[model samples]
Target: MYHSILDTSVEFIKGVGPTKADVLKKDLGLFTFRDMLAHYPFRYIDRTKFYKINQINPDSQYIQIIGRVISKKVIGDKRVKRIIAVFKDETGIMELVWFQSLKWVDTNIQVGVAYVAFGKPNLFNGTFSISHPEMELYQNRHLGRGNLTLQPVYNSTEKLKKFNLDSKGIQKLIAGLLDQVIPQVTEDLPQYILDKYQLPDKRTALLNIHFPKNQQDLNAAERRLKFEELFYIQLQLLHNKQLRQLKFKGASFELVGEKVNRFYKEFLPFELTNAQKRVVKEIRIDTQRGVQMNRLVQGDVGSGKTAVALMSMLLANDNGYQACMMAPTEILARQHYASIISLVSDDLVKVAILTGNTKKKERNILHEQLENGEIDILIGTHALIEDKVQFKNLGLVVIDEQHRFGVEQRAKLWRKNVIPPHILVMTATPIPRTLAMTLYGDLDVSVIDELPAGRKPIETRHLYEGQRLRMFGFMKQEIAKGRQVYIVYPLIKESEKLDLLHLEAGIEQLSYQFPRPDYQMSIVHGQMPNADKQFEMQQFIEGKSHIMVATTVIEVGVNVPNASVMVIENAERFGLSQLHQLRGRVGRGAEQSFCILMSGNKLSKEGRIRLETMVKTNNGFEISEIDLQLRGPGDITGTQQSGVLELKLADLASDQIILSEARNTVIALFEDDPQLDKPENSMLKAYLQKLQRGISFDKIS
Candidate 1:
């Protein structure tokens, strides 16, 4: 359980000098022997299997061919120049073409020399050819036949290839590093744990990973390494949760007093859904236990999350503590402030809104009221974390769309009070179960799985551009029923590369169709001034306009219950979550609502699936699961910035079993030896410490 000699600089390796070392560090983030070791290959080549030239097809993927070069020639003029070599095996002959570095290939390659070539094949005019295949002189091919089972292929960049550092070059460097450093590596796992898991020792696993003796050894190496990686991640999360709970004594709210009772009895806007009541009860229990509550409230749109949050805030208010809510956008903050004000108008509790748009005089009054405990609840955007804003006794913090804030920004709010406040982050974007397990593992989760009664599911349909005239008839029918409409465009201006509909052109055509005297249209986009955007949104909310033609800026906070139809232009351009959110904008009122997804006839496979999923169901969780499958774990929105889901081997979507097992093991270990002070747990502690040095867990935890 000591530091690795692999921590030595990459430049010290025999094959990597200062120049190549710098390029490796900048391009691949490889600077030390350990870095190189952890840079696992994307795939492996079966060197033992060689394909004949005659057996190769155009669709063949990276086949290894044993052949001899018969002739070499340069073809075409200077502009279309290429080096073509006729290579023949015993079965047949094929062509190897290189469009780049023709001079080097034509001069260095010799005819009638036996060689081994490897690359993907392409077909043109009934002949198979390979472009830029890796070639090596074949000598003593049978000397180490059994050893040529698998060849590791590292990923490389075009820049690295210019310096002669392709996959083969990187493989050579790694081989040299392994020979020099593998002897010094020691086992990090305890003997008992290793025996129980049937995992190999660290030295053996490292060697086998880079150069496996057989398929069995490779499987063992992969399992051992994946376990180590996932184990440390779970350990850090679980350990941090334990430490936080043990150290921080949360403010206690023992009684549900005046504010909660009065709101329920007199000023209740609507009967609380059973789901909302359950979620509030969960929050109430957390607040009264004198333990910090870090909870995630996940619910789909129109699912009463705001009602749950308001009730929780009232719980804090009844205990003589102030509550604050932060949203990702100013408009969302204002919307929350307006709704809460309407709900609590008769109640004695005070509420206020703060954002970048607050004037100097209004800001001063609001600031003074917050310090004097006059404002029981304050909702704002990023302005809530500013230094000038101080609360009398901030107890609970609710963040909507919490992923929009960075780790540091959230940390600033956490440090606002002497004792960190209980945090409740709400998300309308329904997270798939496996993703939630990995991303929000440390927090307690409560899901409001049901929408309030009397809310109708939005009817969604997919339409092609050729059916626009019929779609316009549907829009006019909805408008004639005294309901407003929302037409959302993916782009504000047209782009030459993309043929999708644009907002300006859409509005102009719509204006012509429904004429200005009879129909009023409001336009908004991100590029507009905040004041102008606000004005346009206000028009839609107040029913001053019959239709709002704009971009996705209205996707989140503009709640117009009267709007019964939502038409998304080029719906194929949006992600699954975004399409769901936009659909959520309607279906807020008692009237039947419809969402029309307009797209071109030609659609990619994923695009077709997305539109069809929207048409299939309104369930956010189901859509998220399909999204995880189509987009992958890394490409999901908000995952890239968190750094929590940067999994190298374990797929979040598919490896739930492994993730759960790893989490259970960490929890069991901590339950037995809370501080890892036992002799048997020392190796685990040492390994965890080493892993922590490479990753910054503090901010994330």
Candidate 2:
């Protein structure tokens, strides 16, 4: 078998032997020439400007200087060991330091030798020193504005630093390997694509990406690389989508009959929002086509996603098929079961609820009913995915807060029916359009952007610790109005590392303020036993308690219509997605609701932005876009689980336009040549086939 030149091991590269290559592999996951070339810089520093020691200040930017080393000394013990070299220019003297590669630096630098030094200057005591300076011998090198102006900075670990493989070291290795690899890089994109998008060739993009002379070239490089990365990802995703259609013979609920109509007219909790109606239509279109329905339903809190899901299940029931909805937690399962039960007539469709908390006798009866086809709809947590829990004629499977469940867990439900059941995964956490495109690109997406009628937006506010008294008074006033409240903390118990408000302390303080019988309280957290937690939650649900003190367990929970106030303690500690989800717990009822984000005065810039973003808008999609920007692609909700966004250069937050164009182009290409059998797209077809087999495209794509 032939291999690409990029497959050449990094150990074979010049200046990087076996020992250094092993270190590189361990420290930065760089094992081959391809990985090295793909390691793009996070940022760049201009090395054009030159400065003298006398021209430096504490606040000066990264500067380059030419100086001769007069003296060098090793200082401090083993842990704090560092090399301090004094360099003198025509004007004055400045300190050059190396704390990482001490021995290497000590051996390399010669006393009274002229060298070019570049690094950010920092003031230690009274002297300005450049730590871990990039140094090269000054022989006949140009003194003013050298040709290599923009220098790339790659990420490196502390261990890499010890091996002299810092950002500077990695860049040096890449600089040497680029020439050998550039010619090997091939153009995988079709000529039409290249011409239409005006994308540069593969070689030009890779060349300029690592070592661009100017910003314009860098932008062009990024544009092309980002397009290729996203293009291949979408191509693979679309291929899978096409294969899924070809593979699975799905349950076709052709009859939109009695149950679906009756439920829509008489039992829907509220009038169907246009978004929900449109989604139902989409589901109908998908199921009628005889292909498996793998659709993602993204909606904000109280946006009637559950209603849409229930309606879809009714379509299943009407077609003589059993439907099941799975939730992440028992509370959520029971909540879904109750809502679903209320939506459909007991005589029309039998509904059963089973959970981990269900008694053995009850579970046995439930399992028997499920297998016997007596139960038309079964709702539960992970317990529903058990081997014994068989569905008679299960057709529609709705997974709520789907991220909480694993891939295998979802697959088990698919295996329940011989023909893989129609799958509808739902989440109230609205994913950004770009993120949704990448994460659920294979699955058709239906978003419920509008909330139901008569529902008011939850007014959110940020409060500091000093305003506790005022917040307490406001809580009391709300309680006086016969409305319930929720106080959520970051920690269940005192955490030594984090200065967060523990639920224990929070409840204790609240008890003193609200006082005994006048204000009854219920506490729920993850640490509590199943029965105890459920009991507390039920107490709050039944309006037996005025306040519910808990951790984030309340985030995905049963809705309490009377609960109008949600106070999130240490709000800065929560991500934007989490903050939004927690705030969603309230504002489910007709009455006005409030989400008071309580935090310390000292908040990081990102933390402050999160709270402000929450206060600024109730739009989950907007919050998701900002969240994607703040957290990047990996950390945003469920993208990590999908593993599709393990992109080298494309950022889901910033590269929406590129992703859309690439996806559309791939889609158009597929429409023309579904099998990519066209002679015009031969290279592109071959590249995708290799990608499907887990081959790295290297810089080709």
Candidate 3:
């Protein structure tokens, strides 16, 4: 009953009829009064301060003046047409010009009438002018500093402008709707929260956000709205997390027995870093609780996350349960299988590999071994999740690069056994803390911040396209020392629209500089046949080739320790995360490594920052923070598709403090009233129940 007024269709609003309502729906996706209410203004302009016509210079920004139009005239030819009016204030005169809506503006504008004009002033030759200024007749509005108030400026489109629905027109319609709706607006936050935060009620916030009485009220309203939006998201995430802990029973891997101890003592290559040890302990606690573990393990490239994963799986093996690791691509799965095989002795733990590349006869044998518990550990691509593949006792599931697979596919691993196994999702791309808090809110996060010992930081450099000869000379020097080189391109083929260096042309140009017999280059890309691609890759891996030129397909899964030089062509065309990953490919060996970022002279501000960031620091966390600032949360590795970061107003980059506060607030609420069963929290519980009916966190897995 409380929401019925807000749920009324926008077409029923007095100022918005069928035609205008359709326009609003198509342009802004605003269908109801509720939608219109949430359509916030992008900015606010102070209408209290007014400048005289004589005071506005070229530098004056968005000033308002009380003026009267003395005369109007049409100037210029039809192609360069405009309507110009001589507008005079008490002090002096200026020009108001309009390029569009000439007929309507010229027709309705009256002569010698007191009016208020708002726009940025420009010095047109000798005189001052304001083009397409917003004009309104001064009835009771004042232009003094004492009566301080803000006027909202909303976002609009050309389509909305056709029907006299620009920012000002939209504001007028909202004003009318607020008059009828404000009385029925219920408080979003409870009284205790409102008092603690010193927040205005929903009624005052709605009134002040659109037409703030003062700067103080506006700030309070913004805080209220931003907090509430982030608060609800954290609530849903926490609620789902709590429900899962209560409902699901996890397979207990109680025995950390012989295989794990032997792998650490004999098979393990290096001592584990302190960060990795901390993360392993965290995961151990989660698995021992007998509650299903849904944990995300984050680390940079060459951080030894695989070692942690291997040790965890050995726990399953010790407990007499099978484990599987799934990757999105066959190459990655093969790489993982090879890495694990090299690290573990097959006598204690039998490890097997399965992928799309497996032969039918071999697959049948592998399947039979898997079902009969002959396979202690299985590593594969999407083939591991297929219905035909069944495990004797699936106890642990590890997903590499979790963003590449859909939610349903990962969820399939949960059903492999009667009880869901411990889930460990790994990603080399470091996520910012704010984004991590929101996107992976339902799961526990552990970051391996420290790189392995004896690993030297790769020296990164930015070179312009004109330095191609110099780069090739450096590549020759690196290859002369028996070190391999990787040259990556953004595009596989030439694209007329983009000016990026494509692989085909890039390789052709390089072949001339470093001739065939001396250079011995191997080319790889996505378009190549799998067998051919592997053949080229093998040549590079075995040190048969001095230079491996490829596309970003070599970003992951390819780890050649001898490849000490990475040259990325058109580095500005890629984002920070991609550039960081490409840089990680070269720094695997004990030898000194270098990454050369080559770009065109012409670069966007963000592109420059990306290249500069790579050249400045080797920290993946810092690079991810900068990437979040540049590209935002939505574009960061398909977080938009997950729907968890569908924020209305909270910016994950700048609103970190607010996000943290909201999360802490939700945590406190749950701590005080674990199930929202207290009388004081009744409103929050009811709101969650209603909102949950609309959104399914389960779909996100």
Candidate 4:
């Protein structure tokens, strides 16, 4: 019977029964024939040869043996049956044992029967033995010229196995499916391109991927799949970019005012870095061209991205247009409002702050003022996107810490304006260029590579717990000079059951060491309510609290320039990028800053490397790249839902050369066939359809 490939009936698959199908569908989200085809193997096992009994070491757990059953006996009771047998090969004799499977031995083995067994070898009572080894009957037809060949092991759910469907059974079903599908699988790639890349045919790749004859075949199959995945993704991103630039037209603001020039001449704190100037110029050019700007501004922590964003907003304000900056949190919003208000004269520019906590009466006033164009600059969190709030002429939308906002949230902001205000997304996390090209290929990228003048580089040092007293003494000396300090911990609550009780215990210890009576101290964590947390943070900012003890909640928004010293407990537990972010909380002002990383003695090699990288340089990009290499791309971006690129087969750090080549290939293809509608581009179209199954195809158009 023929079945629809996309049908949701799991039982229709060859080996999946009702109960087993439920387990596969519920546990793995595999409910269709297409899902099974896409569920690739995690690894392959080689079962080509058998080793002699004498050649096996006692510690060897995975081995194959060819032997004959010399003797058999049952040792345990009926409730707990144990069967043991002795087998002899050309080299020596070994014991084979099974637990709770007496019937299996009786039906499968006899005194003179020869079989092949595979399992881990163990030593019991000075005899080499294997327990519950997987066995197959030996015959002249089954035995190759010598032994069995390579085997494929699949990942399986325990629930499915209870219904008599396991990894081996799934493997058999996939093999059968591939056999039937191979003949129908026509080539979906251009012959010239395939030849240039030396990729195997689609049918050969599928067959070899499922059941490879040798390592070379497996390698060839892997290359074909990885290249195909990346190529299609690149094609989609480039096409989307072309459509956006061609179809959308943005409102352009004329440079007709001296407000920005006056602000730059009279109120500017310091000179703009070369990187910042270059990026601001790019934004100006985009705005003057009357095209919607979808640009990404990326930089390391304290690399002056915010300054460049402010300059862009100034450009919009000079042309009688309103600008809005959306931060991820209320604290960051308030901080930006304060900083920008100080730089620009309050009389010329009316800046307003709107957060979730703003009073209803006050919010109503701000709403009216914003819609009437009385407020030229507005800063807030997600609350700014509420329907009640409106902008008279929103020319530019600057999203700080862009990763914190979701795609839907950003879309809401876009819908607020008639022309979809020009977007400028900023992030402190330094993404490597290769990953940026693959993930954000649809947006123009502007990077700020320089820091402002008189900004001292944070001096980082790694220390063990044994040096705690010395570190404490240093902290005391620094605090004596009237400089504030920040002591950060990983966890908020104290847990007696956890081995790492550093955060809570350290708080208590510091309270005693600094003597809270002498120096005002406060603590903040995520568990605290927003009001209470803000109160404590205000106390620190107002100089009422000389020392603030907190978790990573204070990592992003809190800007305390006076807090020159940062102490991170259990620093090794954090990724390198996280450690750098925590370090960035300080050193924002003219005062020199220091970051002390306290790690335990039992540090792994990777953990040691992370700590050392933090100490060696304050360069966020360099540390981020190293962190990506050591911990991998997943952890560098935080969770899977962080909108960071999730490549199945590509490693951003290791595959740099391949990524560059793929990008160049994509640009060239689009240059020749912009819509990919040429007869020669049919293969590319089919390949993209197969890769991005459920995503909307209109994104390309």
**Highest TM-score against the true fold, candidate:** 2
Residues 620-651 of candidate 3 have per-residue lDDT tens digits of 99999999999988788764666777666668
lDDT of 1: 0.86
| lDDT (Cα, tens digit) per residue for candidate 2, span 1-701 | 12367778899988889899998888778888888889999988776778989999988988889999999999999999888999999999889988776767888899999998988899888888899887878884443223667778899987777767878778778878886767667776888998999998888988888888888999999999899889878988898898899999898888999998888787776778899889999999999988999999999988888888888988999998999999999888888987777777787789989888899999889888888899988999999888988888889999998878888999999999988999999998888999888888999999899989998999999999999999999999999999999999999889999988899998889989999889999999898998999899989999999999989888886699899999999999999998999999999899999999999999999998999999999999999999999998677665477667788888888888999999999899889999989888887777767776887555442
TM-scores of the candidates are: 0.93, 0.94, 0.91, 0.86
lDDT (10s digit) by residue, model 4, range 1-701? 12344344557767777877788888767776556655667766567667999998877858888899999998878788888899899899999998744564676678888887877899978789998776767664254222325566567765655554555667766776565554655665567667878989877876777678888998888777666656766777877677777877776867946767887788788899888889988898988887889999998878887778888887888887788999998888887887788788877678899999999999989999999999988999999888878899888899998778777888888877788788899989887777677667778999988888889999999989999999989888888888889999888665667456456788888878888577888788888899999899999988888888998888888888889899999898888888888999889889889999998899989989999998899887788779778877666655455233556556778877667766777888888887778887886776566545754321110
Lowest lDDT block of 10, candidate 1: 692-701
Pairs that collide in candidate 2 are: none
Candidate 4 off by > 4 Å = 1-10, 48-150, 254-256, 630-634, 639-647, 683-701
Model 1 over residues 1-701: C-alpha lDDT tens digits?
55546667789888788998899999998887778888787777888888988888767888989899999999999999999999998898889999887766776678989988888999889888889988767884443323657877888876687777888788878888777777777776667767878888888887888788778888898888777767767887787778789988788989899899998998887899888888998999999888888999999998989888999999999898999999999989999998888888735689999999999999999999999999999999999999999999999999999988988888788777887889999999898887887678788899989988899999999999999999999989988999999999999888999997898899778988889789889889999999999999999899999999989998899889999999999999999989999999999999999999999999999999999999999999999998888887666656567567777666767776667777778888899899899998887786566565773321100
> lDDT of model 1 at residue 478?
88
**Candidate 1 ranges with C-alpha deviation above 4 Å:** 57-59, 71-87, 90-93, 99-111, 140-146, 687-701
Model 4 TM-score?
Answer: 0.86
Give the true-structure RMSD of model 3. 3.7
What TM-score does candidate 3 reach? 0.91
Ranking by TM-score: 2, 1, 3, 4
Better of 1 and 3 by lDDT: 3
